[model samples]
Target: MLELKNINKAFGEKKVIQNLDLTIPDGTILAIVGPSGGGKTTLLRTLAGLETVDSGTFLLDGKAFDPTNTKEQEQVVGVVFQDFQLFPHLSVLENITLAPKMVLKESVQVAEEKAKKLAGQLDIESLLNQYPYQLSGGQKQRLAIARAMAMDPKVLAYDEPTSALDPALRQQVEQLILNLKAQGVTQIVVTHDLTFAETIANQLLKVEPK
Candidate 1:
């Protein structure tokens, strides 16, 4: 569902990613593992259109989504981050529905229903009325996953989804990811957690930092 060829990225003079080529098929999970500073997160950012690529292109379902057209790229991607970027003031449901309501122009009813369904899928349904400050690390991460899945994205990008969680909670999140794959979600996870990767990754890519 996604393709990258000759992808390169830099932060001013520092080269973070170079000569990366990967093809991630639909309904499969790809794990990216490497030492710290290996450009793993940079690769995810480039694919998510948060960082501009220096060369090559980002393709979703064979359609080119380049640096010039971010709007088109936004429509097809959903992401979960290690930090669980949930809004502090919004309830869990609001945080989950924000993008769909704003970007997709979906009605409040439609957005709420989608968010609630996702919350149920992630087993966070009971906490929909809670806010970020009220959730534990694991609960917040599940909420973030619910938010991402509420978009019903064709592809999901995770930037070390459980890196911040403690081991016990990390297992909970890992099982959720496995369940997602079983339910037909295509995922790309940027992580060094070899145990989690081994459990779910259909393909593995190792990035070398320069």
Candidate 2:
């Protein structure tokens, strides 16, 4: 569903994402691993259309990313930001369904139904009535994943998803990844968790030092 070729980016004199090439087909979970500051997160940002690449071609579902032509690219990519960008004021269910209801114009009933179902599937239904502040790190991450999935994105991307969790919580998140892989959620994730990499990803890519 996504393809990138000859991607190049730099900050001042330092270069990142040099001549990078990647293709992610539908329903494939791809894990991208790299050392710190090796541009893994930058790569994710580029795919999410959050960072501009100096030179590259990025295509999502056959339509390339064009800043001047945004309609074609927007909403085709769903990103779970590294910081878990949840709305502090909204409850979990509200946060998850906001885009579907406001952006997609689904009815509140429909959106809430979908959100609650997804939350239950992700084992976070009990937390839906609560706010993000009431949840733990893993719960927050799960909430983010639920929100992303609620939008019915063509492709999903995550950054350092479980990097800050404890070992037990990390395992729980790892299992969640495997569940997504099982359910055919096409994903690109920047992760340091090698265990999740070995288990869930159909392909593993390591970003080598430039």
Candidate 3:
């Protein structure tokens, strides 16, 4: 389980998150939905360790930890950004293996094996040699997902996962998330699409600008 208690964040004099509390049970999906500039992305970034909270307690599976520490949080949470930020110069295989080889310090053989497995699971194995520029938006999204999953995090978070997809591709992503849930991966999704949230999320949180 993931829990945040009395979380607070600010920038200069502007408060973005204020005394927010959230709980996400293990292997479940939670969707954060709200209007633009409503602090939804702010909360997601806090969880992803991209931004630090002014005050809060972060708990994962009953263990307390510092959320602001990027290295610590990276071990537990993985994020896929809205832009599907793949390295333009790297092939799909390299993109997925880079972090594990660099951060985890795994042997190249081990990292490649894991990346290939994730590619197979995400249905991008055939495109391993392709660069990010060669991929369609949907394929790029899947590659981004594969890259994050290679980290083997306890919680996976996505920002605006369906923002670029058509209806059919949206359904595919919905099903893919459900499949991940079945595999015991906890997930948090930040999206503006209420219909998409209703279709995939076990819990919903609506944030409004304060």
What TM-score would every model get versus the actual structure?
0.93, 0.91, 0.96
Off by over 4 Å in 1: 72-74
RMSD (CA, Å), each prediction: 1.7, 2.0, 1.3
Q: Lowest summed-lDDT stretch of 10 residues in model 2? A: 66-75
Which pairs clash in the backbone of model 3? none
User: Residue-wise lDDT of candidate 1 within 1-210, one digit each (tens)?
Assistant: 888888878888998988778898888999998878999988877766677888987788888876345574265667798898889999998999898888778899999998888888888899988899999988888888888877666788899886777888888878888898998889999998888888879999877667
What is the lDDT for 57 in model 2? 90
Per-model C-alpha lDDT, please? 0.83, 0.84, 0.90
* C-alpha lDDT of residue 37 in model 3: 80
Superior by TM-score: candidate 2 or candidate 3: 3
* Model 3: residue 189 alpha-carbon error in angstroms: 0.4
> For candidate 3, lDDT tens digit of each residue in 78-109?
89999988899999999999989999888999
lDDT of 2 by residue, 8-92 (tens): 9999888987888888998898999877888998887776667798998978788776533455325666789889999999999
Candidate number of the best TM-score: 3
